[model samples]
Target: MLLLLDTANLEDIKKGIDLYPIEGVTTNPSIIARENTNFLSRICDIKDTIGSGRMLHVQTVGLKADDIVREGVYLNQLMGDNFYVKIPVIPEGIKAMKVLKSMGVATTATAIFTPQQVVMAARAGASYAAPYINRIDNIIGDGVKVVEDISRIISTHNLDIKVLGASFKNTEQIHKACLAGAHTITAPLDLVETLVNHPLTGASVEKFSIEWESVYGKKLTYDF
Candidate 1:
């Protein structure tokens, strides 16, 4: 699975990139709202920190098809081909997706919950259909299943749409999405850190450190 960091602040974004094999960066209105950085400047900062060939997803809240297309074009004009314009799966978004897809700009149709939403996004020609796994699990109790069904549907239809499974709460959620064959996952830094620092794993490492201090200055080494 391709792991993405959904962060806005420069420090957090840089830190997330450092900790994981970050394939991309996912940003939304809420994430951007947390910081007062200029939109284009922060995007530049994100790109600079993450280096080249990594995606940067930007969301647009357009009320009409024309407006959505305009904003999507505007956003694309600012970034490289790897950047994906994130549009909602709403009516106007679907309309906008058609235009952008025809223009060859990558589009990520986000805020997806149900399988029907995935179908619509796939038909709309979105490159990525992002489903909020944690948010759906809160309502339906089996959010992972939605991703599985969507994957199957995409395969059956021979659609090029990717399941960018998002809103993960823990490593378990990520595991489920992977098993379901999601194309990518946009996870928060907190969850990513949790995955890296498993409780039992951390405890064992700590215990090893204490024991090592009695013998040598260091006792850990990885050989390949």
Candidate 2:
């Protein structure tokens, strides 16, 4: 599965890139606004840090189809071919996706809460469909199950789109989403770190270190 960092902070992006095999970065308007910097400059900085080869998904702030298309074109021109414009799974967004698709601009359908929305977005030519996992669960819906259903629907319909499971609150939610067949997932750096660490793993490493130090009176293997 492809792992993506869902943030707009350059420091976090750099740290995540240095530590993990992050495929790309995904940013919404809220994330971008949190940085409180020039939008174009910040996006450029992020692209420089991650390089042009990696994918960058940026959401559009347009509410109309024409405006969304214009924004998508502008972002495509700014970020190049590796960029995926993120649009909401609404009527205008679907219309924008169709126009973007005709122009060969990649798109990710965001703000999704249902499998039917995935279908509509995919049919409209979205390269990816993002579902809010924790948000769905917050409303008493089975988020993981929704992802699973989306996967099945994709396979059954042979849709050429991926499920980008998003809005996770914890590692368990991420794990479940992966198991539920999420082709990709975007999460915060802390949650990504949790996936790489565990108390048992740390304890085991410490035990090994103690045994080695006791035997050699040094922590470095090269010292011997």
Candidate 3:
């Protein structure tokens, strides 16, 4: 499964990249607004930091179909060809998605809550459908089941779309999403760091290092 960082903070993003094999960064208006800086310059700086080859998913705030499409196109022009324009899964958003898909732009359907929405977004030609896992669990208590159902639907219908699970509160939710067949997940940096660490793993590594140093006089394995 692919992993992406759901943040726009450059410092966290740089650290995330240095620490993990992050495929890209995903951002909504709230994330962008937190910087409280020039929008274009901030996005451009993000593009520069992540480099041109990585995927950058940016959401559109437009509420109308036409306006959403326009904003998506504009964002594409601003970011570059590799950018994925994220739209909501509302009626207007689906319409905008169709229009954007016809124009050959990579699109992601966001704010999804069910398998039906995932199927709708895929039918509307979204390259990825993002389901809010923690939000769904907060309201209904079966977020992982929803992701699994979406995954089953994708496989049963042979849809050319992937589930992008988001809004995670912890690494266990991430693990459930993956086991439920989410093709990708976008999470905060803290959770991403958690994914790489465990008490046993750290203790084992420390023990191994101590034993090695006892014999090698503080030399790293590579130095030998």
- Candidate-wise lDDT, in order: 0.86, 0.95, 0.92
- Pairs with steric clashes in candidate 3: none
TM-score of 3: 0.95
- Which residue runs does candidate 3 get wrong by more than 4 Å? 219-224
- Candidate that scores best on TM-score: 2
lDDT of 1 by residue, 140-188 (tens): 6687999999999999988879999899888999999989989899887
lDDT of 3: 0.92
Candidate 2: pairs in clash? none
Worst 10 residues of 1 by lDDT: 215-224
Q: Kindly indicate the candidate among 1 and 3 with the higher TM-score.
A: 3
Assess the local accuracy of residue 220 in candidate 3 as a C-alpha lDDT between 0 and 100.
58
Give me candidate 1's TM-score against the actual structure.
0.90
Off by over 4 Å in 1: 210-213, 217-224
User: Residue 66 lDDT in model 2?
Assistant: 100
Q: What lDDT, from 0 to 1, does candidate 2 have?
A: 0.95
Query: Residue 210, candidate 3: how far off, in angstroms?
Result: 1.8
